[model samples]
Target chain A: MAVLQILEYPDPILKQLSKEVTNFNSSLETFLKDFIETLNSHKYCVGLAAPQTGNLQRIIGIDISRARKPHLNNGLLILINPKILEVSDFKIVREGCLSIPDFTANVKRAMHIVVAYQNAKGEAKILSTKDFEAHAIQHEIDHLDGVLFLDKISNPASDLFRRVRY
Target chain B: MNESKNYFAVFVLGTDSPGIVADISKALFELGANINDSSHTIIGNQFAMLLLISTEPVYNTETIQNAFQIVTQKRGLTVYTHQLRHEDVYRKSSEPGQLCVIHLYGADKPGIVYQVTSLLAKNSVNITDLSTRRFGSESKPIYIMYLEAEVPNNIDTRKLGSDLNKLALSLNVEIKYELEEVASL
Candidate 1:
């Protein structure tokens, strides 16, 4: 497993917005692979975004393959320029971030979503998902827009919990 | 950056009145003691102040306590100063595993949280966060307690859910458990 350096909180790169990928090429492929490698290295991490790693490109990798129940092993998806087309009902879920590694906060998110984006093959597609899948997608998308979960936290008092694992 | 210094806690109690905070803070500033953390609140007819202070070059708690003797005699207040060792500081990471919210609401009664959490603790579950609130009328008031706990891997929630279901029936209180998943970024 490749051990990539993780960016911590208050890092300028983590706050910078990502640029949309216009073309699917070998460089994009390599970045996607490295992203997967870095994510796997963090056993506790379920996903990663491009801006977080200083790429500044609109790319995100998520592998909820091992998630509970039968889930789509999409393994890795490279969304060049994904946009949310539809969202249904807000759902509250506690979320932990790799950037803010030691803290967990409750966040309200879309229960279901339909996203439009371009695939690695340069083909455009739309995908719909709910539950954890939808939540993960929305989180990565927020990172692409320079938004952290701390930004999306609905109620600061109800949402944020300090890491005090003893 | 300067060298790390030790901290102390000062306890001050006097009759409920204004100017307590100003008076205490003024003394600390004059003594060159930094207030790292503090909780000053009035409970009942008395005002209680607990100050977590730090001093460079480490000052004596007795010195500070003695300095407050004049205020104590003047206002009939009780003042105490205590030094804290490194062991006194509690710093640790939060609980791991799946953190879930448990909401219990029922008629005003004792031992609601006791019975529910007693079972959870017996099963090795840890409570990371908790809060409670009371509402409704006095004659028919409702006691509502909200608790957030972490579920360890060994304990599958299905079993806990079933057990809680049985307890809900016995206690006649509504209990709800919801998973709190960490979202990736």
Candidate 2:
């Protein structure tokens, strides 16, 4: 297994929409191995997407167990063509992308989610998660649509908590 | 040849009007000045603008002020220009620190700003941006303040939180602060 180079911001490839993975073959397995290797190579990185590595495919690798703080998570997951079936609850989380290294923004995301995806063998599967794992999933899925965390930022003080004039 | 002294701080103040920005920018454009940083705001019907601009070394504050004379006279505006020092040309990059935002609101009272800011100063927390607004009826005025500060690595944040909690109790205000954490995805 080899670690692939992660692309940074201003790379036009990151903004392009990723294509869906139709064939789950030997090449898909090889890419998943490198993808997991790349995710593990970075310290404290819990999630990674295909577009981040210049691959325009609907693939994501996540393991919230690697987070510094103890959080409820499934050990390791390789999700292909993941789609959010349901999203519930809301939370404001500050996130920094590996691509956009310089800034972090407060983004509101779902606290719980139900997702449908396919495993490497092309078998259909579904995962329901909440809290940190759910947050990581939403962030990775956004990459499939060429959506960056910067697009969903809310002003820390004034945007969500504006006071009503009496 | 004297490229070292090409920066100037320009300020414009006048009654609010639709074309104030257009006229000011037009004057600067005609003078071939590059606007590096600028902020324009409307405060109680007055238009206030602050700009940091760079131009050819031959142009100075006097020349810039003279260039705005026509616009100033026609628009009933006042313009002030000061040549910036060589050291002030570039802004200092922010130090690596934890980004935190503090929001507080309470019944209008004196010393709220002073008390909060002094505490931050003593702790070496550098404030990046701060805004305060007053609301409510005359008899029961409400004051709200939001400030974004950077906490250096050396500072103990838990202790600071407790200290802020104590201050909140004494001041009878609701103080809430959140340290923004960047989760790598």
Candidate 3:
């Protein structure tokens, strides 16, 4: 497996809507493997989306197990054509994206979420997640719709902070 | 143009008005000055603005200040401009640390800001953003402070919290603090 390059902001590919992953062939498997490899390359990256790596497909990988609070995660999740069914409990948390390095903004995200999607083998799956995991899933799904956390900021003057360093 | 020699820190303060920002920004824009960084806020009826600006080398601090004389006169604003020193030109990037938010509030009293800030300074905590407000009824005024700071790696957050709690007890105020987690997605 190879680690793919994550496209940064202002890249046209990052702003375009990702198409559905309809093909469940070996090519799809290969892309998912490379996506996981690229995600694991970073020390604390908890999630990644297809558009982030220049693959305009509805796919995402998330593993919040090694995140801040390990006990509150679901180990690893690979979703294809994911759709959020229901969300509850809204809260604001600071979020930074791999595509938009060096900046973080306070974004309001749902604390609990129910999402339905397909697996790599084209099997339907439904998962309910809360807290950080839920936040990560929502963030990744936004990439499918050409949305960035920057667009969700309520107050740019006070909510945006320049990260010290990557 | 030598941008390095033409950097300045500009401060504007006066009664709050609708067109204050537009008027000041228009003046700076017409003078070919680029605002690199700025913070503006309104407290009650007063407005305060702090900006770091850069201009072409030919425009010195006096030239920029004179350019705003008309706006200052018409708007009844107090303006101050100072050429940035070499050390002030570039702010040193912050060290990786535990970022935390501290909230303090209670009955109005003296030495609240002084004591809290002094304790943080002694512990090498860097305050990045701070805002204080006096509210509630005038008969029973309340003081509230919210600040974000970076605690160096060497410091223990538990110990810092305990110390702050003790200080809060002595000052008869309530203090709450939590780590500001920035999720790297």
Q: What are the lDDT figures for the candidates, one per model?
A: 0.77, 0.85, 0.88
Residue-wise C-alpha lDDT for candidate 3, range A51-118, written one tens digit per residue: 99999999999988756545388777899999999999999877889999867888999999999999
Displacement of the residue A59 alpha carbon in candidate 2, Å? 1.2
DockQ, prediction 1? 0.45
Per-residue alpha-carbon lDDT of candidate 1 for residues A41-152, written as tens digits (9 for 90 to 100): 7755667887777789887776676443345546556676889999998977877788997677878889889999888777998988777777888888898898998787
DockQ-best of 1 and 2:
1
Ranking by lDDT: 3, 2, 1
Task: Point out where model 1 deviates above 4 Å.
Answer: A1-3, A66-73, A154-156, A164-166, B1-95
TM-score for each model: 0.79, 0.78, 0.89
TM-score of 1: 0.79
Local accuracy of candidate 1 as per-residue lDDT tens digits, B1-185: 12477678899998978777777787788888888667676767899988878887557888788767666776788998888876564346344667778898889687787888998997788887677777899889898888888787668888898899899889898989886555545
lDDT of 2 by residue, B103-179 (tens): 99999899998999999889899887788988999999999999988787678889988889899999999999877
> What lDDT tens digits, residue by residue, belong to model 3 across residues B1-185?
24455789999999998999999999999998999779899877899999989888787778988989999999999999998865676545546576788899999999999999999999999998899999999899999999988888788878889999999999999999887556778
TM-score of chain B of 2: 0.88
